[model samples]
Target: MSDMLSIEQREQAWVFTLNRPEKMNALAPELVLALTEGIQAAHQQKIPLMIFKGNGKNFCAGFDFSDLDTASEGDLLQRIIQIEIMLDLLATSPSMTIALCHGRNFGAGVDIIAACKHRIAAAGTSFRFPGIKFGLILGTRRFQNIVGTQNALEILSSTRTFDAQEAQKIAFMQEIREPEQWPSLIEQAEQNNAILSDVTRRNLYKVLYCSAESDQNLAALVRSASAPGLKDRIRAYLKPN
Candidate 1:
């Protein structure tokens, strides 16, 4: 396991903790690879439940854009690809994926939680889809699949931050719990995993992902990512006037 993440195999679940509290658990290349590897390992072992949580005040503040000004276009593209891979992995893994969200879940952080099969969050948690604000198209279809298409459009089209309660109403956050109640809720979920079969779970995801328009959706994302002035727009957003 990489230093960026803590991986633990428990009796009822496999836990993956993002260990970058200092960065508000921002997504980094190493951290992303570590997460991907951890999830892949869980799938290989046929782990029934996988829990993702961040060891910090916030679940995640989104991608580590600290180096955006110096990063080349190739570097930016690679980062986006890695994020896509992780989101896809989480979505399609045979293991039942859960995201325990809190605080700042913005940009790609929103995508991560959206990709999970289950989402639970503490009160006061905040979420935003800032890709549109930065001229990027990311996790649009997945977000649409999680919430309805109209809700997804509403959230993505505006960069305003939404609270956990609002997220629950929209079905983006399935459950909202107090900090103290999180443990019991997670335990309950893990204990209930015994009733679910790995094959059934995997096939369910397969059917959900392999849609007739899957290729078309991906093509749209690719086209948007390659759109002219995208780099400049992202840079401008990150570095504001």
Candidate 2:
């Protein structure tokens, strides 16, 4: 729809590219909405696979703070809800999803990859979950599902940056690709999807993402992130240290 995202349908796959190169493909609300719409349409069309990638040097830098800086608490909560809904759709959609991440993947960017069934990162790509710095609990459960409880705690608590190798070692990233190898790997994925039947695709998704226990952490996150003093904490975190 908007230039914020580019949606294309190939023979076997629907590809959604985040197009905000100037902003490092940041997740502005409109960009999020465009992506969500693309994913929804793919599901409706029964597309076998959907690919999420960024057009810039970086995959994503996370949520655009420009809008949040002036948002009221009520407005902020609504935005968070919208993000949660979009991510949930991505995570649980019947269509298989892949995330191709490169460069800086921070905050909500990391969460986006974690939601995908398949995650491939470029060499030298770095990821960080800086929500602790903002006094928010975004994607805690999904990160836990990717890397488990102990790893998630250590990674989130330290608020330290990690590279693609470390992410793979933790099983957070399923594959790491060199710059030259991306095209072949993506082509292979497309070829593989070409032969997969809808029944098999649905079964694969169910086996992979739906087998997990019903997650209560999302609800807990909503309460924790919306509690009193969050705005104050965010202000403090954003201030020059």
Candidate 3:
């Protein structure tokens, strides 16, 4: 119901669309809360498949820094914490999760795609994980688990932008698909979801999900983001020479 996110049910899947195209669907606090609530609802309703997409040019641009000048460091840290919690929930969700990523995605936006079971990106989509540039460790562990330690280091260390092809090569993306091919992808996922009963599927996810390190991941993010001059680091990262 929140304007920041549009939710719709199609057959057995629930689609949650990020609706802030003007801002590249950045994860503003309100939008993050809306998405968290929507994910929770999908879990409660036992939806078999949960799909995430965005409207307009890009999937998501990452954390909203529009109000950085006015926000204290503590406020920014809390926002990052909330985003991590939401991502943990999505990553460990019982239902099958899919992300349809396109255009340019950065920071926590890339984290969202990383959390999903099925990560499909448009042909020319690109991603950058620049949280480290600001001394933030958000999603590093999960990303490493997805793309391996060496690849993660190379990508995150440089904070460089990589295209969808490179993403698939690194195993960060499961497939490179055009937007028009997405409907069939959804249908395939729906069919796959129907293969298992709700309880069985939930059990399977519980068995397969490696969340034992989630707490540690959160702690690391907190420690890094809580370091002194958090705002200064962010500002420097934003306005590079």
Candidate 4:
């Protein structure tokens, strides 16, 4: 209802679409709020699962850098808190949450996938966390949870581009396939409804998110700094002597 997120339920799953494709599905404050509201409402409705993907082209690129220019410190924190809330909801909700990512998924996109119970990318998708070049921050704290510490450091530090194959290999996504496979793939997710029990889900998440919230439970905390500092250091180190 925020005009930023579109929600629809089909069969047994609630589908949340990132609606800002013109901005490459960037996460703005209002959109974050919409996502939070949508997820909470769906859980209340007893929807068995939630699936996230983007409309238009790519799934999600990342946060809108332009929004940062005029946003207040409090507003920034609030938006991020909302995102954390969404991720937690996705992780611990009685329903199984999945990301059906396609096209370019970068920075915050990686963090988004980390929160879902399962993530899959279309073969056309490309995943990267190039926040190091920008002044943006993506998944640093939960980097280990998704890619493990070593690969996390390598990817975050190198800021390299990876495809769905590498993503699957790195454990960032469960499967990678053609866009045409979406129907069958989604059907597969729908079928999972039969095997998933809410009680089991609750217990599984209790163990998954030990510290309370799902993100915290998963320990997927972002690195403390969002502005640029290390980038400067790395640039300085790379500068001509």
Off by over 4 Å in 2: 211-217
The CA lDDT of each predicted structure is 0.82, 0.83, 0.93, 0.72
Report the candidate with higher TM-score, 2 versus 4: 2
lDDT agreement of model 2 with the native = 0.83
TM-score of every candidate: 0.92, 0.93, 0.98, 0.82
**Which of candidates 2 and 3 is the stronger one according to lDDT?**
3
lDDT of 4 by residue, 1-241 (tens): 7887888878688788899978988888778778888888887877877888898789888766565546665566556556666666665666778888888877776678777878888887887876665444444655567778898888888988888888899898888866678768778888876585877766776777543534443333343433435334435534568
The deviation in Å at residue 215 for candidate 3 is 0.8
Give the TM-score (vs. native) of candidate 4.
0.82
- Residues 65-142 of candidate 3 have per-residue lDDT tens digits of 999999999999999999999999999999899999999999999999989988999999999998898899999988
The prediction achieving the highest lDDT against the true structure is: 3
Model 4 residue pairs with clashes = 142-220, 209-217
Ranking by lDDT: 3, 2, 1, 4
Candidate 3's C-alpha runs over 4 A off are: none
lDDT of 1 by residue, 101-200 (tens): 8888888888889888889999899998887876677788888887898888887898888899888998888888876887787789887776767677
lDDT of 2 by residue, 117-142 (tens): 89999899999988788677877888
What lDDT would candidate 1 get against the real structure?
Answer: 0.82
Clashes of each: 0, 0, 0, 2
lDDT: worst 10-residue window of model 3: 205-214
Worst 10 residues of 1 by lDDT: 209-218
